[model samples]
Target: AQTVTQSQPEMSVQEAETVTLSCTYDTSESDYYLFWYKQPPSRQMILVIRQEAYKQQNATENRFSVNFQKAAKSFSLKISDSQLGDAAMYFCAYRSAKTDKLIFGTGTRLQVFP
Candidate 1:
């Protein structure tokens, strides 16, 4: 079975600094996708960034980016110039190309301290 691990239960970042959330996964499949989803207090899970295993380039979206280390099976999310609005519970997720299901890691709560 595939599993995602988030060692940090909570993280804090200053309003304008960068913060990285670590995630590692155990998967034997060669074809899969990694994602970072943000669930704010509203409880809606929004996609932050996504990376396909076949691509060597890390995925990026505005202030959010992913450091994808395929060989080590590490997918970390880096948020730059953080804002209070970015404070949320971030979940690292994995989806096999063959299935629509998403296997999620225990979430890391991000606190944006002004």
Candidate 2:
């Protein structure tokens, strides 16, 4: 079984500021993919970044990055230089390589302040 948890229910960040959202997961399987997804008010699920369990390096995309700790089962997302457009519901996800099943967290609502 694979499960993802976003401990923070809501987060606020000022424009041009940086914010980190915490996430953790539990899985008995070894091969899997961890992901961060953002969904704005318009209702679109966008992939922020992804990290493979086997990869030692963390995943990064533009201002979005992840701190993936395999041993601790922690995968947190960091947003640098946040903008008003970045305000959205962020979800942490896990997908198994064998089952190809994707599981999502409850989500954290990010509020961008001026």
Candidate 3:
């Protein structure tokens, strides 16, 4: 059984600043993938970034990056130069290499203040 945990239920950041959302997971499987998905008011799940367990390097996309700690089973998302558009509910998800299912965390609602 794998589970994702986002201790912070909500977060806020000023525009143009940086914010880091924490995420941790418990899993016995060695092969898997971790993802950060952002859901805005539109209710669309957008893929922010992804990291494979076998990859030693963290994944990054533009202002979005991940701190992937495979040994500690921790994956955190960092959003830099935050903008109002970045305000959304971010979910940490896990997908087994053998399965198509994605197990998501409770999600952290990020609010960007002007």
TM-score against truth, every candidate: 0.98, 0.98, 0.98
Please give the lDDT score for candidate 1: 0.96
Please give the lDDT score at residue 82 for candidate 2: 97
Give the per-residue lDDT of model 1 (tens digit) for 2-67.
Answer: 999999999999999999999999989999999999999999999999999999999999999999
lDDT of 3 at 76: 99
Residues 3-89 of candidate 2: C-alpha lDDT, one tens digit per residue: 899999999999999999999999999999999999998998998999999999998999999999999999999999999999999
State the TM-score for model 3: 0.98
lDDT of each: 0.96, 0.96, 0.96
Error of 2 at 98 (Å): 0.8
> Over the full model, what C-alpha lDDT does candidate 2 score relative to the true structure?
0.96
Q: Per-residue error at 82 for model 1, in Å?
A: 0.4
Q: What would the C-alpha RMSD of candidate 1 be, to one decimal place? A: 0.6
Error of 3 at 92 (Å): 0.4
Candidate 1, clashing residue pairs? none
Model 3: per-residue lDDT, tens digit, 2-113? 9999999999999999999999999999999999999999999999999999999999999999999998999999999999999999999999988767999999999999
Q: How many angstroms is residue 43 displaced in model 3 relative to the true structure, after the best TM-score fit? A: 0.3
Worst 10 residues of 3 by lDDT: 94-103
